[model samples]
Target chain A: MTLNRVMTVDDDRFDQLAYRRILKKTNAKIDLLPFQYATEALEYLKSPTRRPVDVILLDINMPRMDGFEFLEAAKTELENQIVIMVTTSMDPQDRSRAETFAPVRGYFSKPLTTDDISVIDRLVAQQ
Target chain B: MIDHDSNSRAHAPRSFAQSYATALATYVRDGNEENLSRAYDCARQALQSSISIGQLGELHFQAAQMLCSGSPSPSPETKRTEEFYLEAISVYDMALRGYGESVAQLTAEVLERKRAEQELRDVTYELARQRDSLDQKVKARTRELQAGLERSERLNSQLQQANQEQAQFTYAISHDLKSPINTIAMLLDIISVDHQEHLDSECLELIDAAQATASRMSRMITGILQYARLVGQEAEFETVSLDKLCRDVRDDLRQEITDGKAEIDISPLPDVRGMPSQLRSLLQNLLSNAIKFRDPGRPCRIAVSAAPKPRNCAAEITVSDTGIGIPEAYRTRIFSLFQRLHTYDEYSGSGIGLTLCQRIAGYHAGDIQVVSNEQGGSSFIVRLWINERERDNDTQSGDDG
Candidate 1:
């Protein structure tokens, strides 16, 4: 797939830093857009003049707005935005729940690794 | 004083009438008290013969006519005869009066008897009605008790569901707590790996310490999640062979066994009915602890054996090891969650292994206890209730293995 801009929504500062570091280490030719809250990410996606991203790396547990709530809002706001759940939660129920949403493409554990990035790249390519 | 002849003539009505005539004629001719007394005797005799009053009257009239037909002064004689007749009939009047009194008494008795019978019937009916009413009351009470039992059963089920939900909530919280620790450890690893050239040796050592602490916290959270998951889940029970299970656990801990050069001796074990995975976890934890707490000077010698306790339909499994024995004070506390007797530097563990073992034993309707061996070691005794049928099957298949 021709890689473009990718977005991340996470509440933890360290996890956000780890994701940036891991993505940078992967040496992927893609722009990174990070948000501290799912609500902010949903707002950005809903913006009229916002540049659309190819994939959204979403976190499940967050303050104020959770991943499921964001997915519910995004179903109507976006047409074909692929969301990949990268979360610290190892709960199978959360993974299954995220997969229930139409836009969700894949689920991964916390501290996104170079291998997980490759998996995401392949998922986006298939989509 | 009637003669025998007059008494015998009384048996015949015609003869009695002639005798009464003769007696009357004598009474009239002689005008004597003796003959008049005789005429009264004739009437008494007639009453004794059970003659009716009308028959006696006819006999008297005949006797009076006979006396009048032959007498010169018939009028006076006939008057006397009629007087005698009235006297004779007085005897019958007295008898009839006695009979009427008895008849009245009998009628009164009959009425009393009928009243008593009616009262008895009423009493019997009332008793029957009371019995039926009591039956209805008993049935209603039984229904009420049944309803109470059903309501209690429903409440008990709801309570069980609430407990399961609470366990699930605990599991969720533990899972959420684990993520941040894992993330922190990952971040520390990144720093230690990427910034090692620019950082001094002390800074790198501090990072290592931080990473170790984060790893320990992560392990603790994972342990809590596992314990909570055991409470929330309902696993199926099957026949589990402890001998095979021990071999599998040994294989799983092969790396640790090789590193410590631990000698594990497993005896033939009995089959029990339990959750296979939980039982495996329980044995694995015990084996892992035995290896982890081995004495530095001596070789680690671990032995596993089982014996049947027929009284309770259970098997007593003993896992004894030549390791650092627990003191008497901490023997009981070792089974409790997060109760550590050693520092992290001495022993690396989440301190939840024994707690998980205890929980798994409880799930199988069993219990586990620790005993300090006299030979400077520790032994864990687990009593697991086994199905009698499974035990029999195990006995039958004992020679096959």
Candidate 2:
């Protein structure tokens, strides 16, 4: 299982930037693609892309299409892509709701550190 | 002639017969069953004392004729009406029996009267029994309604207690989450320093912006927790001097006053009974607003005055300032939580200061309002009743805070 492309769906630009910095610092060789809107990201996944994304970093709180809605739509549309939920919400109910999706591999709070990237790296390697 | 003379001798004393006639007349006139029953008792006594059946029957026959004529309706619904009908039947039956064989036609009349009396007695008995049962049912229904009302009241109080507990839980959660936000801000600062060589100016700015947002969020959360804590707080009430309170608040805002070039004048104020800390906050909020919303053209001039309102009804403490007056439309809404009239750039506030002031005033059984001053700026008046006993309506319970 050789993985290459990586994708991130988050509304916050800073958070997306943080992920870019963390991913570059932890594993620079991995390919990264970022989307500000969940709907656009889902559309991209549904399209006949040349390379399928191996991992997706999804934020739960967003404008129109939230993280949960994206996961539900992406489940039937996309092939095997590991989802790692990224959110600033401290709500316990949100964690339980996120876990309901089969494709979700992990969950982490905002300001994701380099240590968190290592854990994600290991999870991606398992795929 | 001798037998006739002896009859006249017996009729010479007519006292019992006269008394019985009078009672029968009263019963017929009033239509009261009790009176009719009394008439019957009188007749029975006269008979027991050797009054002739012929004489007793004649008196009863007259009473029966008067009662039958006085009968208002046929279907006796009331217990008294039933009694009257039964008594009338009994009197007529006895009168017919008195006629004996001397009046042969009365034998048919006696049989007819006896049959009618039996029918009426059965109907009256049934009606009386039904009335008694209905009375019992009404009493049972009343008891059921009273019990239901009490149960709902008890449930309502329980619901109120549950709501208060839920509020406290939410406040505690917000209070606890503040530390994590601070930690995140601190971590971002550290990351900026550690990656300075690798990071560009744009990246450093983004990190700083993120840290600022985190700090702002923490402040907002703290404001919410403060508001929630006020709902169920129990503070000891004391007689506080407003002049001293204003002085203390001025001291707290000394730096702001100096920066804004503001002058605060305090008048002789009335002593009020309330929670000292809450009253101080109320004064501090109003005073801070007076300083914050000052006109840039001139130095801020604020006067704190208190006067006993006419008729000794309530004491009014006014905090008048030389600041831009608030529009009348926004005056009422300003007391609401998170309602800000100006942007964060123009006014630096969590928008919870005035809200807290309103809550504190409510706790002390007072009201705070802003009105335009004729001399320019705004006057925020706080009306407080002198008598603490009248403050019962605004008193806070531990569960409610």
Candidate 3:
């Protein structure tokens, strides 16, 4: 399929549940998937089955491989995709570092809801 | 009782007239002696003038003959003069010694008084120095307090802004989540009513779980909305029927209390002036907290009471619970937004309940605080001010704009 896709990667089961429930409400013309494991999700996206994810929702805290590590590894392979780091932390230094990735589209907080859709949609349009 | 002999030896009285006569006469009598020769020379001319030269010579010879005879008359006239001269000489010697002693004593007294004056002057100077130093310290301390007050004011304004943001977060949650819950609820109701026979048991069970989750989400959203509303609107001050109001609140929360294995005891409630709904929610939040943070050892018992405020001035309402009380360190933090002493799995609600209660109490010109140990249950006290209620409402509402 040529249609663009959006996906989320987080270690938390509750975060995945909340992300799915929220992302399903989007009226955007793109496919979306959520994953709890970074490597498995990365492998699947790298395989021919999933193509051209338009937006990525990456969470910071995970078991072994965190969002920063995932970004480092997948930067070359999926350099084409727009990455967004969503977390509960309001730390300014982290935000600045995330901004170093030129393709980063947005950063948001926890309890993700329909409120976040407009910002993401705007970002997707501009890109 | 001084000894007279000792006193006499120490000093003697002065005789001025006797001392003058003795000095003149001794000069006349001792003209030949070296000690009084100067006086004798000065008197010789006067003596020669008083007697003719031949008579002076004859009187001298006769006086010398009478003085050697020891016959009690140098001539009787010379005898009287010689005896008076002897008495005068003794008086002169006594007067000289007395005058010397008086001069020495007066000099000593003057020096002693001067020394005492100098010591008093030094003590006065020291006291002045101490007073000046104390005055300067007091002024410096006052300035420091004023500066500290300004800094605290800045922090207070920042805290007020944070509180407003927390309230706004609630509004956002409500506005964002309500429609989804309603849609899910409606969809489930439609399916259950229309397609009862067509649906299998497992499918029915899945749909039931979905509906229940949706319901729970709806309740949580409503709770968040109520919390936001309590903080957003200005408080309304009126006569609050404490007894009836609490009863209604208890009735509303009875099911939740029972579900959590709790008992609520309402002591006699005093009629107070406050916003009835917000105050009811405040009491409800406290009681609900008692249920939410229950201990393994204890079935929760919430005790509510009211008594005359100290100094017979205000009214106080107390709510004590036999649940897992707040830790001593969390007493201040529990009033903060999203401050959860316990984890999410242990308690099933948003962490802003007590924060809402605090905001409501603040709006009513009242304050609420908690006192508890590590494992012991907590006692919460609410102090109210009826006269300041309108002013407090104005202040709470003023922050929004």
Candidate 4:
């Protein structure tokens, strides 16, 4: 599938800034949508008037709704979108748990590098 | 009195018969009170001579017949003789009555004694049954206590396992914190490289300071993760040569040693039983600390030596350094986690090295003590067991971490 637009769900503002900067530096032809709360991200995915998101970068730890809770609450809305778990968790258990979700396609540590972006692009090409 | 052997008193019974007849004839002829009393005396004497009741009856019959034969018309005399015989026999009748009362009393005493014996047997049987019941109760209670102890032991083991898992979880969290700090440092680097021409020197210096602080925080987090990992994991033990281990540590810190103009003197040390990787970390931390905290006026000089405590099967290894010494008040506190004596501007460190060293020593069934040397330096004395048996003994005594 061709990459189009991406959404970021993270509680940390600096992490969002880092993502924006890295994505801008890469100059990839993709739209960026960022949400500080997983609840807001889930609502945006459910809205009919909202732009269709091709990829979702979900963080594990957040307020009100965690990444796993979001995956559960927006299961039907996220069927056409690929979810990539991006968080500051290096725990193998988190990776294994993310693998249980059908929408989750990849896992990466925080401050996604240029190399990580290329890997995501290649994952999209594979689909 | 009664005759003990009636058969041996046959001659005495014949004499008694003649005496009794004479007394009866006299009493009948005289009809006096004295003669009548004499007749009673003769019968009493015969009874006292151990004669049987049957022999006395024969003697009376013979006396009665003689009196009747002597008189032709002897009706009155015969009546008097019969009255005297009846009086004599009354004495025997009174004796028989007293003997019957004595026999009845003896029979009652024997029956009472038999009842008392039966009661004693019943009481003894009851006591034996109670004792057996008590023994069984005590045995059952002991078995219950043993089972309770075994259950508590199992719970204790499970609790220990849970605590280890919690420590592992803490380590993972600490490890995750490093990524964000790294990103901050990376972003600072990117800013400095990409936008240096647009920013002032002051802003660049501030960024540099922020980057430095972030790096220090990263190191401290790494130190915490290391300590947590050690707490959660168990290591395999092996025989370690201290002499070679010390040389290896010195080689690992070659750059720092050269920069500080440090000299390390190692003697022939003893072999100790411990985890090799942990021991290496222990020595590395000590040597690194010595180099980092050296006196500005003097070159760093460190000596590593060992002495065997044969009585305890232990080796006392000393690492003495000619560096800035620790104060007496902080000698014990230096081993606490995150306890620092100086700031990052003076000497940069995570402040967890000594704590790790102490933990490693405890893992080997040992302890570490610090003392100030005479030359204004510190000596770290570590006591480690020389063999596995000694270590096991120490561990059983609750000395290990």
Candidate 5:
């Protein structure tokens, strides 16, 4: 199936809900695939049957494989795809680390509301 | 010495014989005649002279006895022999008189020599002892100086490293901080300015969300800047009046507290010493924080007071708020940069306000103390001007220990 949406990979259910709620008002035709578990998210992203995403909202703090791990797996293959990190963490080192991914767009902290997803408009426009 | 002693004769130089006799007499008197035999030539000569005098006396007496016997036919040869004996006795008596005089003089000289030797030995021993003590003291002083130099070097390097790290931290914060904020802000500006009225309800929601995020970001950047300034990254300090400082700060926060829900009580604060702009900022942040974090149902009451230590030498100012007080676990955590106890939805804080306040106190050679309970509110005590004498008094506070 052709997918023209952003995937939010987070291990916490509340965070997924929050990110999904924030993404609802965006004018972009985007679908949000929230993975509460890391392994499942990685499996879905690696599957050949799934179409590539326009952007990925990866949370920094997670169980199993974190956003960093997901970024590593999708390294060169997801070069064209935009990755906007979404998490409650404000650590400087995490932001610096995310810089390694050329496609990594913006970092957003939690309690994300409709306004925070405008980065979607920005990122899609850049692509 | 010549004018005081009145005895110029005592200093006459001794002949070899006189010197020998004086040394022997001195050694004997002191009971240390270990080399007396080698040094007694003059004393032996004096004894020989005395023996010669006794021989002369015996000869004279014998001649007189012969004359008294009146031997009529005295031979010319016997007369000649008697004359010779008399001459020999006269010469021997003269030699003995000279020896006696010489020995007496030598003995007197020996006593003087003994005193001189005793004084020389005492002075030498004393000098050696003083030299040894002086050497030890110099060594100890040099070692102490070296230790002091090393400590200074270590302190200097540590200070340099700390400064470098501070600069880097500020730079990193400044350099990377703006890009994200500007990007977010630019995005918001573009959407709100370009596509606001034309936007549907859903699109309008995006604009609102972006504005909130941008506003929150701007507040955080301001908070971090305040934190840096408070952490001694800012330069120079000017004297600030306490009463005026508090009033100015209160005035500055007028817009913040004008929500009119807060009851702020500020007594006259005593000024000691500090930077006004920074202090005002500190007061403004603290006052505003009190108003911002109050209980929703109850009206917020804030009290600001200062405690001075003896004639305005040092002061401790406290800011207390009757708000939903911090939990016991969160007290220590509140001073860390960007550490927030409450979520943004409940309370709006950049989380760097108290952290900056503490850093400011430290920069002014002061400290901040926090006290609070779960039910009650938090009171922050800031102390300044901690000098040596005050520390001594603190140590002597009658605690039995």
Candidate 6:
């Protein structure tokens, strides 16, 4: 199965570039949609003409409408998509709390390694 | 005695017998055989009067017991001595019947005294048990009170810590986000400069200026976050060797020192209790400031020394620099956040170096003060309390914020 679309919600431009680079290295046929703010990502999801996203990489730390707030705002609309929380926070409580949301499937720390990318690849193949 | 009893003449016989018995005892005690015989004669005369059998028996019994008892002088085994013993035995036999009644009375008195003694012992035992129970109750009450006091103290400190953490979280949220903004601005500069041949020099210069401002803002933001975090961070306290801390700070700023031709002289320093990171940052800020504000004409000379504060037994660390000294009027203002005596071009800094140092000093329950040195330079003095209970008392008086 080929992955069609992936969206990233993050405030940091550097992290957004790094995540895209990691995915590009895998040569996966996935369209990347990046949002500099969680609110923008939520708005994009709410828009009528938006592409169907297969998976979302959500960041916990953001300027306005944090990743959790975004999830709360778009939980009903995100029923068909898988969400993977991405954060630089070392607090384990953040991951545990994110997992309680039905749409969230996994949590990964910052600077996603090759193994993390492989795990994501396998998970996408299963879907 | 006869005059007092003249009206009680019925008691005459008994009194006379008692007097004869006394005379017989006196003669026997003195070992006077002739007087003893005369006393026996007086007794026989008294017996002729009508004394009671009990009294007669008591009188004879005493005279007999005294005769039989050995005298001070040995009595020779003579016929007269044998006769005296015989007479004493005969009188003793007659007195036994009367003595039986007196024996019963004496036995009854002894039993009553024993019962009274047993009752006294039981009462004493009960009083002792009650005292022990009361003592236990008092001790239990004291333990409960102590536990309650400790719990309240713990809760109070926890509330204070929560308040501090809330304030820090707000400041860190805004300040920490600047790091990414700086990175993005630098990346923009790199992209523009790498393709300078395709772009105009005027545009490239503008990008460079933007990059420089972003980097400086990044440093300032970091400083702001660091200052704010000092309130909430529960950094572990350990024994810090001030001399070693100075050496480490010197190593970290080696490049700056070489660029400025600065010399750092650290004297023997005392060990104190404080967070290692905070103490290191405090020294780093002061040292970097000294180097940055150095007089360009001469080599920069910095001396780090320590002495004990007499009032609180805390170590007083003094970092003195032979550079442009701070003016007396601006000394207090320099320690405040973002308060700068010089412009960014004049002396490069985030303008929070002294503020960070002051915050770190406060974290250690200490204070930082600046004074003009005799060598015409600035001396930054930081006092740190030793690890002890007095630190808590001293820390409570000052506001960490």
| Tens-digit per-residue lDDT, B154-246, candidate 4 | 999999888798888879889889999999999999999999999999889879878888988898998888888888877788898888998
Instruction: Show model 4 residue runs off by greater than 4 Å.
Output: A1-127, B1-130, B133-137, B197-206, B308-311, B338-348, B386-401
What is the C-alpha lDDT profile of model 5 across B1-401, one tens digit per residue? 22333443343222322343344334433433343333333334433444334433453345344443554446543454344334444454566688788898898889789888988988998998899999999999999999999999999999978976895687578657868888888888888789878889877776776677677877787776656555545557766787888887887777778784776788878866788777777788788888887877777788898874433237788889877777666677788766665545556677778887877777677767678834388787878766555555765443322
How well is each residue in A10-107 modelled by candidate 3, as lDDT tens digits? 76556776776667666444466777767767787678776676788998765335677688777776666778788987888878887877667678
Candidate 6 overall lDDT versus native: 0.75
**Number of clashes in every candidate structure?**
0, 4, 0, 1, 3, 0
Worst 10 residues of 3 chain B by lDDT: B10-19
Question: What is the Å distance of residue A119 in model 1 from its true position?
Answer: 56
Regions of model 3 farther than 4 Å from truth: A1-13, A16-127, B1-177, B188-213, B311-313, B342-344, B373-375, B386-401
Report the Cα lDDT for residue B34, model 1.
Answer: 78
The lowest-lDDT stretch of 10 consecutive residues in candidate 4 chain B is B1-10
What DockQ would you assign to candidate 3? 0.04
TM-score of each prediction: 0.54, 0.49, 0.44, 0.57, 0.50, 0.43
The residue ranges of model 5 lying beyond 4 angstroms of the native Cα positions read A1-127, B1-148, B151-158, B161-165, B168-176, B232-237, B308-313, B373-375, B387-401
Q: Please state the error at residue B187 of candidate 1 in Å.
A: 3.0
lDDT of 1 by residue, A1-127 (tens): 3456788888655577677877776655658899887878888878897897878888876644678988987787757888888887788888888878888888888877778888887887887
Enumerate the candidates' DockQ scores in order.
0.01, 0.04, 0.04, 0.02, 0.04, 0.01
Give the per-residue Cα lDDT of candidate 5 at B27. 40
Give the runs in model 6 whose Cα sits over 4 Å from its true position: A1-127, B1-162, B165-168, B171-176, B199-201, B308-312, B386-401
Q: Give per-residue lDDT, candidate 2, residue B14.
A: 60
- For model 2, residues B82-133, the per-residue Cα lDDT tens digits are 4543564455457557655547657677777887898899889889988988
Tens digits of per-residue lDDT for model 1, B1-401: 24545666635786777777777877767776777777668878888877788998898877677668767764778777876777678878877888899899999999899999899999999999999999999999999999999999999999999989888998889888988888899999999999899999988987987888798788888888888888787879999998999999999999999998999999989898888888998999999999999999899999999874444446788999999898886787788776666545667787789999998987786778899886689999988874545445655433222
Q: For residues B1-401, write the lDDT of model 3, one tens digit per residue.
A: 12333444322111222222344345445543452433233234323234333443344344344444555533554654444344433443454577688888888888888888888888898889889889889989999999899989989998878878888887887978999889989999889878989999987876886776677678678878987777677656899888888888889998988798778888878887788888888888877877777776867777888874432215578888777776565578778765555423245555567888888877766678898734388888877773353444544432221
Model 6 over residues B144-218: C-alpha lDDT tens digits?
999999999999999898869775775767475786876778787777867878878877766775676677677
